[model samples]
Target: MSGRTRLRGRFQLFATLLVTLVQLPTVLWLCWLTRTPLPLAVAVPVSFPYLRQLQSPWHTTAPALSTYLALGWWAACAVFDVLMLPAALAVQAGLPRGVTWGVAGAIALVLGTDSVLGRPRLRKRVVHVEGLSPELDGYRIGQLSDVHCGPHAPESRVSSWVARLNALDLDLVTVTGDLITHGSSHVEAVARALGGLRAKDGAFACMGNHDYFTDGEHLVRELERQGVTVLRNRGVVVQRGGARLYVAGVDDTWTSRHDVARALAKRPEGVPTVLLAHDPDLFPEAQARSVELTLSGHTHGGQLGVPGVRRLSLARFVSRWTAGLYRQGRSWLYVNRGAGTTGPPARLGAPAELAVITLRRA
Candidate 1:
């Protein structure tokens, strides 16, 4: 095997081991609490879905009922462990087990409900640009990102989101990567869903790291066939009335295909530029290049966070550009919370997001 492939395998193995290890304590605790067999409890969570997936290829079109049940159980246990681990520690520190369990369970119940049942809503924001043209003023752009359309986010959910975006009558729609997760089997479904997006200016997208995981090139072609332009280190000019707005996109950063300078090459000198980058970390490069607005969605708004406290989100551990609008000088960055969940298929304070951004001349 190639070095990269071997490294990826190792990484996946490491991650799986780490997750299993983390769940072990909770598994033991639960077994003890409920007087269940420790071996069976551990085996049940550690195997099932994963083993099933390994033993038999996933039927993406219609997942097995047992697989669904296994996934649901595993997800619940993972969330439960995360919620209860601290409480477990507190109990070790001489706190009453009953009180700790009560408090943690209550918190878990509230957050778990939000995570599993919450949906993305249209979030409206107005951005004032210093030198935006009158013709491009009040421009309505719909941003969708990290829509991991697979078992977690089925085609129905994706289609529903597309319908909502179309209903807004947006001037333009931008998807900032991660159209699919799990595998490439659902690429066509996601492409078809995205194809339904209607905007005066049309829909455009940039690749995310996950897309690369599932044949990025193939996904790009499929998106193109569906009438969605997948911009890869390229820029396009959209003329509205008498003014021109430059829209550029770069490849995902994770795959080392991001080239900000290349994406902006040969741009019209005086027109204001907006960059569609999958990772928000590119804001610095785009901002330095004087791009007026940079749209991104990779962090998933920290996916799990406190309702009022932005910094407390789980995404904070990895990215500074968690969600919402950020500005430095004349450059603006807006990170959408994303349309679907990834690994855990859940959301808390940071519900899935569909950004309705209106650009105004300052």
Candidate 2:
């Protein structure tokens, strides 16, 4: 490695060490409160990285009971850090201890309930296209995005989601990427489940940043092997009842694979077209290309926001297109709330989504 790279790695290690050390006080407090021993408390943080490595695809070995217990302890410690730190600070600031504790408890309860019970639900929407043919009007398309199939979103859970999607009787199904996160171990099962989607026009998918991160080429091959089309910067013409609807998808923008022109290349003019992009930020480019409707899902609706209020999402701080349908000029964009969670596997206020969007002639 280059000198700069080596130095960066060393700095990262040092930073991790510092952070872990700083959590010592909180860890001790938690251990005391729960009547746990100090030695075990220390092992939680030390074994967290070890447990993660053991669970990774490269390990090829099952984790032991101790590692599993360590993992749970680490998760509990992490949760305490997130939920109790503010309350602890409030107590230090002369706030009523009971009030502060109550606030923290209420917040934890709310987030816990949301994360555990907020299953993905079917959300329906209608989009009016300016020149949509009668033959293609009322066409239904199911969209599944950000289905991060890993430890948090297991194969069985994703398969169930696909089963529900199949029941919708969609003409076409589009998966807007983020198919897998953390590793490629679950790619085959996830691909097989997605392939089971029943639609007249079939299922198609575009890449997401996580897919690129976790072996994009292998994911494409697996999905293709299961008979699901994976679109990478390309367009295809779908015909039904003597009318044509152009469907296209660009590669993930985050990975620098975004090529709107390339995706829409050689498209016949005046055909109603839809673009499936993982990021809603691409909506401007899609609109510029005169694409009728663009489907996206990357923000997960901030993964924490009030229901029915997309603008209130924390993702709004970074992008205006957090979730929901947005219209500009004659083009429209719909951002799915995503079907899975990343990181903590917790979502508050904002629920997971399985969107079924219908197209109509304006």
Candidate 3:
């Protein structure tokens, strides 16, 4: 009868409907792929979210860890549906059953390689920016984003990332956000690992939606304690000799409101500013303020795409600025594919990235 109870009912109904809808494709593929339908395996992933939402007291509000983890498993199985679509098309085109089976096997192999190997490796890249501050020209800013630490990505990987970044000998560093996936029990350990990262002008970060999922402030405090600047809707001037580089950050545009103007208020009109934002959709606003560069990561490049092709992804269904570089007017936005996984432990086409953005004066 209460509004809260009504909302909970609606959410449960919606989740149940979703699970039912997805079941057809998931079940069809399991029978087609494995040649044996395992009822227990199918039910565990497909029904977990729906059941968890219905059973838990916080049905409409906060979700339990098991719920989040179940979502991950469900997401992984979604790929099987995608593969099945193509297989169905092939069958419709009069392909032999034997040929379709071969295709399914190939798909499984690709998925295995990507989830086990490609997604875990730390990929390095260089981005060249035009009109970068000459004082900062050739200056390397290491970027680590979407560190969905906890279950999918652990503290050990975070420590390894820190060692890798320190080895780069970067002049400046920024973590675009999502340092913690859903909670912050090991936030201090992750922060301590990040503390080992050495940069001439120090390391900075912004917040992401996932960070706020659970005790986000705890992670922020730990980061600060470890000497990393948690820039939340604030700006600071970085000096190397007499040259000045403006650095600022705004809270996540999707999770929380992004106050771009508030962040750049104290910044001069054009002082070669670098804004740390979690979502690339904020680029237009940053461009309005003449921000030279913006760094972000949230999409994880959809976590599944054509490996050789790279740019194509389901993530594009939601965001055109899902990953990679884009220029509008004088401002440039670089959306790192992110360093960790969320939802599912698998990443298909998009590999984890460690960006070294070099300021190149043209």
Q: In lDDT terms, which candidate is top?
A: 1
> Which runs in model 3 stand beyond 4 Å of their true positions?
1-107, 116-130, 254-257, 306-312
Q: Residues 1-362, candidate 1, lDDT per residue (tens digit)?
A: 99865655565566457547745765676677878786555556545455434321223232445444444444445566777768879999999989989877666555555566667878999988887898888999999999999887889999999999999999999999999985788999999999888899999999998898787778888899999998899999999989999989989899899999999996899889889999999999998999999999888888768766777888787689888999999999998999997765656678888998899999
Residue pairs clashing, model 3: 72-343
C-alpha RMSD (angstroms) for model 2: 5.7
Lowest-lDDT window of 10 residues in candidate 1? 53-62
* TM-score-best of 1 and 3: 1
Instruction: List TM-scores for all candidates, in order.
Output: 0.75, 0.73, 0.72
Ranking by TM-score: 1, 2, 3
What is residue 207's positional error in candidate 1, in angstroms? 0.4
State each model's CA lDDT, in order: 0.81, 0.79, 0.75
Per-residue alpha-carbon lDDT of candidate 3 for residues 149-212, written as tens digits (9 for 90 to 100):
7755678878888778888888888999888766557687778877777899999999988778
Cα displacement (angstroms), candidate 1, residue 286, comes to 0.7
